[model samples]
Target: MSVIKELARIINEGVNTIQSKCDASGKPFPSLDEPYTPESDAVRIQVIADALPIIAAANQLIATLQIPAMSIIVASGYVHVSAAFATIAKANVVEALREAGPQGLHVKEIVEKIKKPMDPAKLARMLRICATYHIFREVAPDVFTNNRISSLLDKGKPLKEILAKPLEAFDESPGCAAFVDILIDESFKAAAVTQDHLMDPSTAFSDEPNQLPIQRAMHTNKALFEWYDEPGNELRRRRFNIAMKESVKFEVPGAILQGFDWGALPKGSKVVDVGGGIGGTTMALYDIHKHLRYVIQDREAVIKQAQQVWQTERPEALENDTLALQPHNFFEKQPVKDASVFLLRTVIHDWSDRYARTILTHLRAAAAPYTQLVLVDQVAPLACSEDGISDVPGATAPTAPPPLLPNFGLAGSMVYNLDIQMILLCGGEERTVLKISQLLSSAGWKLQRIARVPGNLLHKIIATPA
Candidate 1:
């Protein structure tokens, strides 16, 4: 079959599958016109095992059919889209529209509700561009309403509450809004100077965290995390903490249970979450396997925040010593020598191989003979098909059928985008499985297996002492 025909067939099959599933559940497939809710069944169905290929194929078809010049132009202009999104999200336009109801409200009314001064005409144009991309709905000439995509920015607070405490706007959010804000604000600024950072002799060849594009952009010598903890960056630090917790929303429900068997561990086995920001991973694990003891290690400030969270969410865990929030840096020697499992979720990718290996080696030194190390991060695949490194003992990544780029092209672009974002913010890069295996091996750990966290690009890599 021709490329276009094949793409159409894949999309058709996917739509049928989705419709049939929804019908079986006695609920209609969700409409873009409706506002988003986390409890909606639509999210669950979309992330099931079978829906991934269809989603990839559909995205690839659009990219394949678009005029090449137009596609590039549109891609280049995404900065504007992000900027507009940040503006609306920050100004609480989503909350305003939520109050206005489905009929929508005039752009002027939205501005008035937000209590922020913005030109109505300019705001309309911003919403219009976003609407063209299906983010919001331009119900009338200068009126806008929240749609499925736009409503995801709602922080679940009243307009007055959000406006009165602008700094605390994202506290009640699901993290999407904060994530978008960070991407467009700091990440965007850092990404803009990527070319300059890459070409400058002083920084081009450096792998030091302090020499990253963010440093150049923000004129700071401190590394990204250090910079966030600076006195003047309190708001950014809080938003980042919220965004990190929100990262789990991208995963399928019960994703942490997919790979390694937590039940197999001996009763009361200690699980050390290294560099675990605010104990998100540990909290997820504790929810399922309260039989196990948990220790969450991070910077001192983050540990304090994690303490606050535990006080509110699970005070008993703290009181009973079932979960401990310890302020420890992974770059230093591991402190929990008796840990049965060392969990690194989205941690290793924040550093280059040299730094990553160092962190892993510390854990290796502290690990008991039977300690299992679980590294949860994105395993980037090549754009074309080829047998991966033979030395690793895990299933290779699946490739797409003919005409689609082997890595599923734009459908699988999140990992790539994150790779660049890592580079821009810190001297880090997303690694291929082979690279990860090598890093593990250098740290005296053997790659045991790899498992996908269904619905997302993240992989659970299990390793053990070499």
Candidate 2:
């Protein structure tokens, strides 16, 4: 197959795998887990294990490009080799070494064994370059062996479904093509020119730092609810929505439901889901606290889509009067009077601190005395090591100590990956506990408590207006 075809194929497969696993794992989304023992057939796992380094290399390249430019770089070789080489995934080098085994293998042998039908000369050159990074041990000039990082490529480690799908899926999607093209263009510009100048806002790039190419491909054309507004844009809208859904499948809102303590609310109190997308979190919360009156507030267009989903999937579950779909632009004042609980999920992160403060300030004013303000997003844990252990008490703890604990791998993967995504997308940052506390305090809310839920994948910072 052609290089772009192969590249797209791999990209889609990796993303799909990540998404599917997130759904299966029952967290807010899919998370990567470590492999142990032998499960499934060894050969298939070996293929994944073998593919790790190559994928890592690809991701490294992908990461270097602005999010918008990634797809284009792969499709058209739109990226410069120098930039691509710089962005290669360190994980790839490590995996390649792990595959070297005890005796190690010559570059030629490694390529033929792992990828098969290899050109000996090309393989030799790639291996030599990889050796420079200590991805493998250079036993002989052209031979290599596994090292600490390479060992992680072992089979059974959780990979997301989005990353594991067949190439045809990506090849079939026009949005994917557009997204890739723009991503590449943006990546080239960023890699060659922009990031360094970003520290100073005086630079031209700062005018729209977040408007990178990927944002154009994903949000501008496809948009979250633009289809509902324009009849001809239905396909784009639906496709965009699916991409958003796929992107966040593993980020299960239900996990937040688990962390939340409903008993703290007054018995007959009301909770409103402001700007709640698709009612995923609303449904999850409803399941958790059946007694709390739940209302959903979003744009009329989105609410139509959400109500339809609820009616088809959960007609009987949601009480007729309890859950009402209302239209309200959060930038304007809130319409609801005397709410006991005001909940915003994945909403606050979309704006700058100034605008974010405006939204929170409005909610704070609307809140009655003793009201709870629940702001839920992927609150990044304080920086921790690969072990997922943090010195802070309320941070995500390993379900059990490392080496034996499945939870350790799960928490580590999600926190690390999401942190990277948040930084790139919109300057919507994931905060540590201290950062979050300060944000809330400045917004006229106080963090009364934080609750961490196991297996669900989220922590609830229950607060009240100060």
Candidate 3:
């Protein structure tokens, strides 16, 4: 069944479970038989409202799963769907051919290299399919050359490794919604059944595990935070961390670091990277300003990973007088009493407005009057382009769609889409510049300045206490 259809099915199961419980307790059940009635109407409405979170969460997990599934599907053609010949050629076969160059592999050699043995007829069929997909050039009959798609694979980028790294985390899809489904349902029940008393965090989340050392202090959830920290839960941790890292790597954080003048800071002045994961950005920054002092604050797991990576790859940076790694919980309060700059990169986006404000409020309270706050994030454009029709009569181009990368020009859109994904999975979101300004302003922060980073895909939103 389609993933969407399966999502609908899973959601209905949640609704039915709620209905069954209501019926058992003598609450009037929504009539499955009756299409619309005042008596059943209220119950049906309640069920949907309660089920939205689960439904959303389920859909997100399903989407993440599709990446790997689709990658695999593209590599190995199914019965009905044609292979992703173009993508495969660029990503896989081309790489092998580039290595061999003019002296291309024989059919048997190619099969052995790809590690999957196929009968002569099947090999012929695959080569034919690949030709249609532009994966293999017909250099000679029964012999082929790697196309662009296949070339990418030869560059040490394996389909499975590349695909798996980002999504290995977060395995529970819509099907597993029942686990957290009941908790969220109970939250609604608690709010409705009791007065404001049950709504209190202290009471509702009493049994909840301690918030994650850094990020969790800002938000709390037992199942999720623990799952994020668990060593055995490598897939969830790696994928989740990488997804967060990707936001920094591709655009905002890198740009912010690159565009801003790092060397201007006082040599001894410290910059605290609150919630910095594995010091990926920190390393990037250090590479730029080797003399600047950097303090990386994160949970033990993430901190340990960061330190290990630093020790192994950038041991010189760690050994020098320039950097220090520290663990911190931003929620309890920041550890740095004072610093030249407090860099909270992409930390605020993973929160509700209220929680985000609290985090900013804490930062504001902690900062010295002259301290600069650098919020590395994507500041959305003020307006989208209008169609050419407005400018001239009968413009032929019909508003040429935004320019894109060769294979997919919509890479920027994909980055923004991560905002929506964050919202669905963890109640976090990417923010527009205006939304960020409003949030920072509310927390007594004044927008000092905003500038796009150079040669990279992000911006630096500098703010300070009002």
| Candidate No. with top lDDT | 1
lDDT of 2: 0.53
Task: Specify the highest-TM-score model's number.
Answer: 1
**Which RMSD values do the candidates have, in order?**
1.6, 14.3, 20.3
lDDT of 2 by residue, 336-452 (tens): 777888988777765546657778888988888967888776556443333332443454443322121232333245665545443344434566666777777888997776667
What residue runs in model 1 are displaced by over 4 Å at the alpha carbon?
A: 42-50, 390-393
- Full-model lDDT for every candidate: 0.85, 0.53, 0.54
Candidate 3 residue lDDT tens string, 81-111: 1233322332234434555565565666565
Q: State the displacement of the C-alpha of residue 82, model 1, in Å, after optimal TM-score superposition.
A: 1.6
Q: How well does model 1 score by local distance difference test?
A: 0.85
Name the regions of candidate 2 deviating beyond 4 angstroms: 1-254, 317-319, 382-413
> Each candidate's TM vs. the true structure?
0.96, 0.52, 0.53
lDDT of 1 by residue, 265-310 (tens): 9889999989888876788888889999999999998888889888
Q: Which stretches of candidate 3 lie above 4 Å from their native place?
A: 1-226, 239-254, 382-412
Cα shift from native, residue 393, model 2 (Å)? 7.2
Question: Which window of ten consecutive residues has the lowest lDDT sum in model 2?
Answer: 29-38
Give me the displacement of residue 24 in model 2, in angstroms: 22
